[model samples]
Target: MRRDDLYITVPSLFRCPISLDVMKSPVSLCTGVTYDRASIQRWLDSGNNTCPATMQVLQSKEFVPNRTLQRLIQIWSDSVARRQLDAESAAANLSVVPSQEQVKVLVKQLDNNCYSSLEKIVSFAKESEENREFLATMDGFLDTVFDFMRNADSDIKLIEQVVKILDLILSKVSEKKPLLESSCLSTILLVLQRGSLDSQIQSVRLLESIAAVGGESKLKLAEKEGLLTELVKSISKDKDPRLIEASLSCLIAITMPKRVKTKLIQFRTIPELKNLISEPNTSVSTIEKSLKLLETLSSCKEGKAEIWHDSVLLQAVVQKVLKVSSKTTEHAVTILWVVCYLFRDEKAQEAVVSSNGMTKFLLLMQSNCSPAVRQMSADLLKIFRVNSKSCLSSYDTKTTHIMPF
Candidate 1:
């Protein structure tokens, strides 16, 4: 397609966001991107590509251009210009060609092809960091990114491409927090809002990301938006084991401090959790997850002692761990370790530091535990004996392991 033809066709194809017309020059801008070529380039030159809307930072390596299509566009423009001059001359002197409209459509198709090529090229440019030539380009690029993320579902192909790009960006830079805080994070949240199960699963992973790259602000915002709770419940409610495990892992990361960690364990005594802990279909990973959460709660100086204050809560946790058969070691080791640490009062100590704790461990050790669980159980017994002189001898050997967990 000739350059003139490209002008006709390209705009119709790319669906330029700014002008709501065909992309002419097609430049990404800061305030709003432009389809005019000169404007897009000027924006790039001015370092406006990183973010048009929010002015966030973006790496230039993100973009990669298609050179073959670039050459085709140049040739297409030359042909169209020559053809146009011929048509205008012929129409002035005689009847127009029967195929004039067809020619226009053909030209438009070429332009669409050219514009598609440029889109890939610019996307590459974003990835390759090739356009990081100036801060102005970065500014425009970021603006462009916000536009795409906000309209991610504009095209199915585009959605797949954008998700791919997001993965790359996340992998490339660990500190793209500002970009994330803008529409990118929101887009991911929207994935949760309307996406299928796979998308929902992917959405929960953003929490792990926020924990890694963001501080208090973004996470708090996400939490307040109910995304955090949504993720937690997704794990608890999902029938798919893989999705359940992912939610569990995300929850474990989120609850690392007293202010956060205590909430999940707070429901330990609740009727809901009591039922969950007793459900036969629960996976080992999920139970282990709860135990790890408890460990985090126990280790938090501010929240550790509160577990014992509510005897029902304490009983719920202990009873849950003791009832486990297949998922026993994980539950036993984690609960033993955490309970021993947080069981505060003399009665609590009698439970945590007591030999009965050792008995629980000893029973679990006799089960089909792996070396790690057995080792941990033995270690817990030794620690209990040393701290509170509680041996595993409180109950008769035959009946001890049989008591209500």
Candidate 2:
């Protein structure tokens, strides 16, 4: 095949399933599956014991180099490289790509708030992957955009655009210092509170990104001035799934801190999360997140009281255990275990048993759940059985113990 044609239509067999790129070196696993060496090595390094393409558990980590496939790929790659060089030479004469100096100038224009400069910079960054990487490497570029948002006063449109640009820039840059600043965080919270819906979505997305990078410190900053409360309220009120997802993500990030978990309970986040979970047409992810948050909140006394106080919510949680994904099942079961083991509230225990929670627990033990989940299910079932017998025998005079209704 011609080199240019190879670029246009490389054989599917030449591509690594994991990287979805033309393979440089092919290796065969014990499963007799071929994959790119680097991609499979990284996958194995990440502790994966299953074939990425076949989803079959690997019998061994050993990989045999496929020299024949490697040679074929090398020959094809050489031909394609030669054609790419010729094409690049031809395109170089027809086009004038922006220089690093020119991009720096656009970056300066962004700092000065030059007319249409933000739009131009955003356009340039989005023009190609190379441009995005170049912009990311520009010193102080992310900080300048962050400062623009922080200093934005009366210009809502300007703030919105800056946030939009920040979102794009964040996707390219891994730097976290600019995003962790107090002024930048306050600006993002303000946007979440007062900006338009689109801007609010962008701001929440930016907050999620910051939380991912900032870890515990950023989470502490997020809890300031009832920001976490506002996030829960947004999740409860926003009809947009995207916005709700972002808000939940931010909440999840901050709730990692124990103090923040207690603070979220103080914010009465459980009721709102319960409402969100009960909402019709809610996505599984939203429901899963709500349950996960509840799992965290339930670790505290206030959270347990709040969850048990609402029988409907307790029943809903029981129903969610085996009904959703395994992760969701884990979270739901953990919450139940916490409440049942720590508090040992008879009413709550009775509520769960009556809701067929016992049956669900048994089903989960037999189903595909994590060992921890099954163990919790067993513990809960044992507790429920003991509690039911205690309840029955405590009232009845007979020697026989009957299950509680």
TM-score against truth, every candidate: 0.46, 0.67
| Highest-TM-score candidate | 2
Which lDDT values do the candidates have, in the order given? 0.49, 0.74
Model 2 RMSD in Å is 17.7
Deviation from native of the Cα of residue 161 in model 1, angstroms? 6.9
Candidate 1's error at 60, in angstroms?
A: 67
Candidate 1: global Cα-lDDT?
0.49
Query: Candidate 1 on 314-359: residue-level lDDT in tens?
Result: 5556565456554544654555455553242555545553334556
List model 2 lDDT by residue over 1-405, tens digit each.
333563686878899999989886689999888998889999999999999989999989999978778667766766776677687556544555556687688777764655466666656664677777877778888677767766736366777767877777677786766666667777777788888876898888877777777566666565567567678778863345677887888788767766787777877788788877775557789888888888878876778888877888888888887775777788888888878755788878888988999888878767878767766776777777645543233333221232110
Per-residue lDDT value at 403 in model 2: 15
- TM-score, predicted candidate 1 vs. hidden true structure: 0.46
Candidate 2 TM-score over all chains jointly = 0.67
